[model samples]
Target: MASLSHLNQQLLSTNTLPFTPLNSTPSISPPTIGFRSKSFGRPIVASADVSRRVVYVHAVTSDDEWGPDRDVPYAGVAVAVEEKPVETETDKLKKALVDSFYGTDRGLKASSETRAEIVELISQLEAKNPTPAPTDALTLLNGKWILVYTSFAGLFPLLSSGTLPLVKVEEISQTIDSEAFTVQNSVRFAGPLTTTSISTNAKFEVRSPKRVQIKFDEGIIGTPQLTDSLEIPENVEFLGQRIDLTPFKGILTSVQNTASSVVRTISNQPPLKFPISNNKAQSWLLTTYLDEELRISRGDGGGVFVLIKEGSSLLTNQRN
Candidate 1:
């Protein structure tokens, strides 16, 4: 006897399900072998380690050993596995796209490298789009969506110093009413104490599964609203340039009461709406990707636009 060791096992008939394997791969040692008595001239019997996929069985490999002549003892162990919440591929890609827009100033300050990376991410997300024929999915598209990122060069002027430093681009949003089949695109500008917006009201027709033809009917130059209290900041920054507006702060603060009444009266009037007679007021868009909170579309001009649903975490995170 080569120093008989303890071996624990249960004799099982080969008929039942052996064991449900653990959910992980395990490292097992070599089998134990026992030599029969030489005088008796009996062959040696060896017990091999058994393993199953994802599950580990307590075969006889513990520090406590048993005699070789005994049958193998088997016991199933209950492993407490910590399960992690899973994120789908679409969720991962959506996060990547949102993170890419952190400091790019809505793609206005994005460099070529950053732009290429964004395009790549957009393409990947488009490939994994869960919603098909996004135009027909009117219920999903019925709310206002804020523009988060875009490659269109046409909107550059609004985002750049062309708007002058005294005013800043407050928001660019698209509001869609599926029931009325109408769309309104608005760009808001915020000044020292007043906020103004320019919007286009358009009617859309679904021309295809993924395309919609939109003809803008009217354009509105919204009367400036007296929203912000007259408070002059020490300085203001726009497109990386900061200016000292503190000089006018005191003078404006003195006359704020007078200015507030005038702005309020002017804002009380209805917005100015004009018929859009220009041929350029019509365009088509192809929705490439859409989910509950994020959307990506391509315009006829070959520019990509990425919009986030209003009140989503992407906007909240950006604001924070």
Candidate 2:
């Protein structure tokens, strides 16, 4: 009998082979041959016939640089040669696609449009929305005045030392020194209240809808020695009413004496506990009137808008 390996070579040339099983391992059937040519990307081979003890096998290997060298009758081997079938372009394409993204991570998979939609929805939820102002101050601002906003200069050394004082009403201009602050209605008032307020440390805590507590450094009130939160009510107006000074929108009208600067801003980010999502964008409405100066700043944390108005108010109107 010809060598099984030699027979395989002949089968390659003749393109004719028969299905059969191996002699030794009848249970171990003959090896099936898979034909893969440079031209045929995908080739399907037939299963061996275990009963015959003879079969044909095909394989391409660069290291070997050839098919099975020569099939030999070693260990009860039965070999038969057969023809390999050709694959169509469509079959090749389908197989290629399946291998690319099917079972494996790289295999062909389903569309992600649903995921895209979800991502888009999330983007809308996290989107930066411009707060709508009740009024724009374009017409109300023009000329040099005392600019007073939240201070970037931190606390005036002595301001936090002790009780501050409410001073005689001073001219509102761009030059209120650090020691000139007045408190009224629980909100501290800083000087140089122009389109901007700079350099006087102003801090406030919103304890409740009916109560807000604000504190100014002692030195910022012109009379740093006697200023106290208790006496703040005696100097400024609107002492009894609950006040809200958040800005929902508006641009900067002018600066008192500072260099050309961007307006500040305030955000109305609801607590995460409130549970707001893209589906409820409109429900989480932040409404306010913008008739004041705003200060805009950029730093490590992020940008913030500080509403700087001698006297302005913000309201959250319920959404329809």
Which number leads on TM-score?
Answer: 1
Candidate 2, residues 179-272, lDDT tens digits: the string is 2222221222343232111233333343332222335432222212211112112222366865432241122222221222211211122212
Q: Give the TM-score of each candidate.
A: 0.68, 0.16
Off by over 4 Å in 2: 1-153, 156-158, 161-305, 314-320
Residue-level lDDT of model 1, residues 1-320, one tens digit each, is: 33222121221222132332222232444322222221122222222233211222233322322333334344543222334558888888888888888778788889999898999999899888888889879888889999988889988877895258678888999999999999999999887777889999999999998899999999999987875356566888988999888778767786887887787689779999999998888999899888889989999988899998998987787630
Best by lDDT: 1
Error of 1 at 123 (Å): 0.8
Count of clashes in candidate 1: 15
Q: Summing lDDT over every window of 10 consecutive residues in candidate 1, give the lowest-scoring window.
A: 6-15
Q: Which stretches of candidate 1 lie over 4 Å from their true place?
A: 1-85, 161-163, 232-253
